[model samples]
Target: MAKVTFKGNPITLLGNEVKVGDQAPNFTVLANDLSPVTLENSEGTTRIISVVPSLDTGVCDQQTRRFNEEAAHLEGVTILTISVDLPFAQKRWCGAAGIDKVQTLSDHRDLSFGEAYGVVIKELRLLARAVFVIDKNNKITYVEYVSEATNHPNYDAAIEAAKKA
Candidate 1:
């Protein structure tokens, strides 16, 4: 498991850590409409999965917005922002932020994505900050388990990987 810290305090993460070159794990997360959005739904498109603890937080909000802005130029890529926030809150945040390009999905119900990606923070029940870039064939090409939960991820490298895919 990757070492992670929240607010300078070490937190234990649950599940197996994923690495580049591995097959991307499939997880069912709820879209803003409360409908299930699975990895299979994104088949045939390069995907940038931005995992955050919550959308209401500053870092998570910025990360999602950044991806939304970049999505316009990424012709064949799909950007997804997964968080443990409820569907209602996620939908409201997207509406207020005018975030259309990045699909904001909620993992509160099942924690499927969090557990599968080894990002679930046992103490807080929130996901640690991470970034994953999966190719159209569903192979992970880039993986970043951010050392600090509150910090932003390497946007450039993740974006470049998606572009290449």
Candidate 2:
């Protein structure tokens, strides 16, 4: 498992750690409408799966917004932000933030996505900050598990990987 910390304190992350060239794991998450969304739903396009602990926090909000802004320029790439935040909160945040390019998914109900991605922070029941770039064939092409839960990910690297994918 990748080492991670929250606010400088160590925390345990649960599940398998994914790597580049591996088949992207399929996990169910809830869309804004509370509908189930899985990895297969966007199989034909490249994807940037942005994982954050919560959208209510500063770093997470900026991370999602950065990806949302980049989504407009990355044609054929689908950007999805997954967080344990409830769908209602995600929807409300997106609306208030005017975030349209990136789709926000909720992983609060079951932590399916979090567990599959090996980003579930056990101590807090939130996901560690990370980013994944998967190709059109559903093969993961890039993976970044940020060392600190509250820090931002490598936006340029993630975006570049998505473009190449």
Candidate 3:
């Protein structure tokens, strides 16, 4: 597992850490309408999976917004923001923030996505900040487990990886 911290405090993360070139794990998450969304749903398209603890926080909000903005320029790439926030809360936040380009998914129910991606913060029942770029072939092209949960990810590196994928 990748070492991560939230607000400078260490926290346990559960699950096998993923690496580049590995097959992307399939996990079910809830869409804004509470519909189940799995990794297979976006097959045949490049993906930018943005993982955050919650969308209600400042850094998470900004991170999602940044990806939403980048989505417009990345043709053929599907940007997804996954968090432990409830689907209802994610929908509300997306509406208020005008985050249309980036699709927000919730892992609150089963933490499927969180566990599969190795971002599940055991202590807080939240996800650690991370980013994953999976190619259309379902192979991970890039993976970043943000060392600091509250810090931003490497946007440029992720975007570039998505472009190549």
* Whole-model lDDT values for every prediction: 0.95, 0.94, 0.94
- State the lDDT of candidate 2 residue by residue for 1-165, as single tens digits: 999988899999998899999999999999999999999999899999999988999999899899998988999999999999999999999999999999999999999998998999998899899999999999999999999887889999999999899
Clashing pairs in 1: none
Worst 10 residues of 2 by lDDT: 148-157
Point out where model 2 deviates above 4 Å.
none
Q: After superposition, how far is residue 44 of candidate 2 from its true place, in Å?
A: 0.3
Instruction: Report model 2's TM-score to 2 decimal places.
Output: 0.99
Report the lDDT tens digits of candidate 3 across residue range 49-123.
Answer: 999888999999999999999999999999999998999999999999999999999999999998888999989
Error of 3 at 165 (Å): 0.7
Higher-lDDT candidate among 1 and 3?
A: 1
Colliding residue pairs in candidate 3: none
